[model samples]
Target: MLYDLNIAWSPSTSAAELERTLRFSAALGYNVVALNHTITPPVPPQVANPLPKFPPSPAGPASSSSTTPDQTPNKQPKLPTVLHRATLVLNDPSAYHRLPQLGSSYDVVAVRPTTEREFQGACLNLNLTDASLISLDLAQRFPFHFRPKPCMAAVNRGLRFEVCYAQGLSSSVPGDAANDARARAAFIGNVVELVRATRGRGIVISSGARGALALRAPADVVNLLALWGLGSEKGMEGLGVLPRGVVVNEGIKRSGFRGVVDIVGTAEREKGEREDKAVGKGKAAAGEAAKEKQEKGVDNNDKNGNGENKRKIGEEEDGGGGGPEGDDNKPMSKRQAKKMKAAIRKAQNAEAKTT
Candidate 1:
């Protein structure tokens, strides 16, 4: 499925606008989209997700049951699978101590590092914070260049770098053309450096669009990234594979065992146990049938009153007896008798010769 990991969201954003953007995204072929709420330092002690939940879109799995005739008439177009995401603006390392707590409140957790030190820390030390995406505002020129060591380090740790194309897109505001041009240039330059540093891997492209107007189709987004020096394959990956990985990784961090093992549900466990019991019973029945068949054969043989029958069965079992009556009265073979007669003749001749 196509994924857009970052769609700008805030308290000031109207529900109508968000819904419109989501619908537009779905129309553009994004199966899943995350609404990103940017949070700054000094996080509140009581972390709660403020993003409002919307009803499942008509195209969603639950839509068949959730939508009714009355609601269908007024229902809007289907929206993509919407997920709540929180992006912590990491200015100081100390500000991110409650990252795990924040993660519990959001479906996905990301970090936007402002300084070189913060960027490096986010890349190398993200495991401690339980953050998945390293979102950089590539529109602004950074003092430090994207180095391979730290970028690859993050990739190795299963972390993704987010490049928001919305930052480079021209705004609707008048007299902002110069700023837009500069931002676009900076975005292109930074993207080239990032693609180089990470060797075109572990990069996720997101719209980061605040409104419907800013979002682009998946194909357009891929082409845009490809023009920015990223390969077409990698660009497609950014929109699909990498972003999906981020969402899935964050989900595991919440629901799985230390993000390594997932606990199976009780129903699933019970089902497996039932299947095993069935197999065991089948094996037991087969074994019992074989044993009973062997015993029945023995009983049938025992039913015979004549001792001859028993003797015949024993001889068959013993691979044919020496004689029908008994082994003691069995006659010797012609070859054995011939050998015995030859020995006697040789002995007589020797005695006579010695005499």
Candidate 2:
């Protein structure tokens, strides 16, 4: 399924604007969209204990049980699933402590490291983060010549590198068209370097679109990635497979380990099965011990001058070792007889040594 994981949404945004953006995104074939809330840090002391509440879905709850008023008997399109996500802009490394708590509160937790120190901390120590965003549009941003070591390290830990395309399209440079053009150029340049550093392994191309106008078709986005130096297959994976993996992994991280295990029975039934297995093992072990004891006692009785249970040693000695043809005597091979004689002589020598 196609996903647009970053659509900036806030409480101040009008409901009408939110609805319009979602409808336009759905029209462009996006099956899932995340309503993103960007939190700039050096977090305020008065900030609520929990993060602000998530924004509502664009069109609210979908009525999938019955056809809509305009639907025909055969024609109906599926609605998109709305998810909540939050982006944290870290200005300092001290803000790392809050990520785990914040991550649990949202469907996806993304971090935008605006400085070199923050970037280093994110790659090396900030294991709680799910996505690493390069927010070059911000006043505070990392340098263009960042090393590949950190980016590749983040990829190794299942963190996806996000390149937001909407910022370049919506450049707000406070000057004439020439200034805006320059700003767009810088934005694209940063994106190219970010993609290069990650080597397109964990890259996710998201619109980061704030409105309906900012949103582009999925194909348009893929083409944009191609222009940014990623191959066609890698671009497609960034759009679909990579984002889906991030979402699935984030869900698994949130929901405990049982979500992955295949334990499907009532509590009482599981308990009963365990107890039954233990009882069967105990019975088999006891039977084996009893059989061994009976054999040992019979041997001891025969050795204690009781001839009733013991066979004649001379009759049993002529290459009469146990073989497949037990009841009938068969001629043994010369090699087999030789080996049996050696074994008997070795046993006699051992008995003589013990005496």
> Which structure among the candidates has the greatest TM-score?
1
Give the TM-scores of the predictions, in the order they appear.
0.77, 0.63
- Which pairs clash in the backbone of model 2? none
Q: Ten residues in a row with the worst lDDT in model 2?
A: 63-72
Against the true structure, candidate 2 has what lDDT? 0.68
Highest-lDDT candidate: 1
Could you give candidate 2's per-residue lDDT for residues 1-355 as a string of tens digits? 8878888887788876776787788789887777788887765544332322223333543211112333222232334666767678888777776766665567777888777788777777776434433333421234646579988987887677776788777564544677667667877777777778888788887887778898988888888778978888888888889888777766666664633433335655588898999999999999999999999998887678556324444334544535543334555555566776898999999999999
